[model samples]
Target: MSVSNTTDFTNPSTFILLGIPGLETAHVWLSIPFCTMYIIAILGNITILFIVKRERSLHEPMYYFLCMLAITDVVLSTSTLPKTLSIFWFNSRGINFNACLTQMFFIHCFLAVESGIFVAMAFDRYVAICNPLRHSTILTSHVVASIGLAVLLRGCILLLPHPFLARQLPYCRTNVIPLLYCEFIAVVKLSCGDIRISSYYGLFVSLLKNCLDLFFITMSYTQILRAIFRLPTKDARLKTFGTCTSHLCVILVFYIPALFSALAQRFGQNIPFHFHILFANMCLLVPPTLNPIIYGVKTKPIRDRMLWLFTHKRT
Candidate 1:
């Protein structure tokens, strides 16, 4: 933890990223699982995109949002994992300041966008289940496109200030980020300037985005559930609810680890550093890796398409 006197105080050119604070000795071993997850995430998401695109029957609002989620997952995972593996494997930890900010922006921006996509997917389910007669008309192609645009813009606009704010802060302290990637809070904490504004702003934005999205998702699912129970036949209820199972699983996969990681990073001061970092890495990796698998297994259309593709390739 020795601070170098020669380090630039005002504006360092680069910052050193310690992949995981206390797990330095095990970085090589850690890279194995991380690399595997990265490969799976990329291939799975790509397969999802391919299946949805090639299968004309799957061109509905629900799958469109799934495509958006897949794309976001790819970007989100790509923004950090390569750099993380580099840090772990080669000990290549020096990240240029601007590159760090870029990484931070992509990571946070797509994370928020992913949350918004979940809200959109939930709304899609609500319409399909609760208002079956008008589902297609309600979520038309134009409307779906607009929803995707709005979600992307909202994420970009909300997170655009993060890099600027961090840049404005004078880094009179050590230019060392003690995390896997350039996390917003970790980078900002390096500034010697008063960081209350940045900290509060980050907190406010995080809570605002997650809470609003969660509220909308919950409301949509509530209506969906009520609609499901109102169906007279048990078979009808089961069949209808089954359509939502995949989406619900994807939502849980994305949110549970995300929320837990955020809470641990912000509040769990007593949590072990390595544990927190590992959990946070999983929070990012698990969703992308599992999302395609979840949908492929639970959604019959996707499952069938994937099987056909694989079997056809063999033939």
Candidate 2:
């Protein structure tokens, strides 16, 4: 049965977000942890950014990539959390149409940019490990600047259509989105018009950004591993492997939850809706919170700089 296009021609100017259904009673309690995680994510990424910017010794290709990741994390987290916490704490779920579209656009754009950063970082690692002699030559400041521009442009241009597509649709269904934030698919699903185009575009972008990016990252790591194994001494291999441990942890933390949530949404029919919702939220939240810590612990310069900053401030 087709949904009636003429049932309610008057579209709503504002939309409401149904944030974490079945948890209404516990929203206040939920806000506590959500607020804490947001604070930690912002502060952690800021600290990384500040440390990298301040410490001249840390001004290298790796740290520059790390800073890009930090900026994306901060933007991604802030794009969703303020409104998410607002819905939880202040019961402010009403968002105008344009605002919802704007939020969704930035949320997805930063996500794409972040994924691009991961691929760039993977390439950086491959160059540093497999072509040590040419690492500096390959990843000079000009090259890094070019990579940054490419990442930004790829994200902005590719994700540009999503919001415009959503805006063109007639949202005659309920204005209540079923996610914590205004996700592209969720908003598209609310449209009463034919959504085949939007659905296919969403799938195309997902595979393009997520699957292809992950494939290249995995290939990069495979080459890095192959290069490591070719090293003569065990100590050299161990030392080389240690440098990638942080990126590995970050990859696992990011991709696992993201893939899980995506799969669960599509295939897990018996899964609870709340489980899907929370996992989706975690997909956005956990990464930014963990990235800085993983880097700080696994990378020596960042950890030492952080310790030094703390100690130096004591005077």
Candidate 3:
């Protein structure tokens, strides 16, 4: 659907989302898995929140950061999955321009927040393992609150420009976004006007959000590994590293798929459109779906508490 350059055009009042592009026939079937994942993500994160809040023993700094992560996961998945499911089930694909921008804002803002939460989690583990004696003192209630404020502000401030820049463009080309949700890049690329600024800005934000956070998390874990190796005995070293296993697993599941999806969206021109769309949806869904399960299985306290909760409920 290409528009002629000579055609006089105005900003589209509504954009049509072509969910998963080349897979329209399978959309009904695909909705089955997507709906299932959304249910799991919502239930799992909410259960994590409940357990953390109810179990006094899980009220430490690590669990507090986990609560933040779980909350972010809920927002992040919620921002996209419902609309995606709608597109699959009911063919509800038209999104008003303002609503599209709002969705894009929430998606990117919470994504950045999620990245920051991972960094915070890494720091919590570092303090607990590398400087165990002063961990509580370093990460006081006030300090934790400050970190959360900084993270939220950073995401809000940095991503606030995206929609404005997008709005400034003359979207005369086409209003059909070949995505399940209103992705910032996909929406902006529909504009006939110059999009270099938007593209560059998106790249800059991605680097700052993902790369910089990855750097800090890497450094924190590097120090943690060194400290773990310095412990007296094999059992002690394993015990220290055990505390970080859940965080490490969550980070891997969150970052790897996310980075791959971003890169494929930007650079993988030869990739099939439906594959990209499917992978993108998976990238978003997998983290929230897996985070709680990973933590529950890897972290003894959480696992024990979850078991107790279920047992108590059954009784």
Candidate number of the best lDDT:
1
Off by over 4 Å in 2: 1-9
Candidate 3 per-residue lDDT, tens place, 24-78, comes to 8999999999889889999999999999999988878999999989999999999
Runs in model 1 deviating more than 4 A are 1-8
lDDT of 1 by residue, 197-266 (tens): 9999999998999999999999999999999999999999999999999999999998899888878877
Clashes of 1: 0
What RMSD does each model have against the real structure?
1.6, 3.0, 2.1
Off by over 4 Å in 3: 1-8
- All candidates in order of lDDT, best leading: 1, 2, 3
In order, the Cα lDDT scores of the candidates are 0.92, 0.90, 0.90
TM-score of each prediction: 0.97, 0.96, 0.96
Clashing pairs in 2: none
Residue 103: error of model 1 in Å? Answer: 0.5
Across 177-248, the per-residue lDDT of candidate 2 in tens digits comes to: 878899999998888899999999988998999989999999999999999999999999999999999998
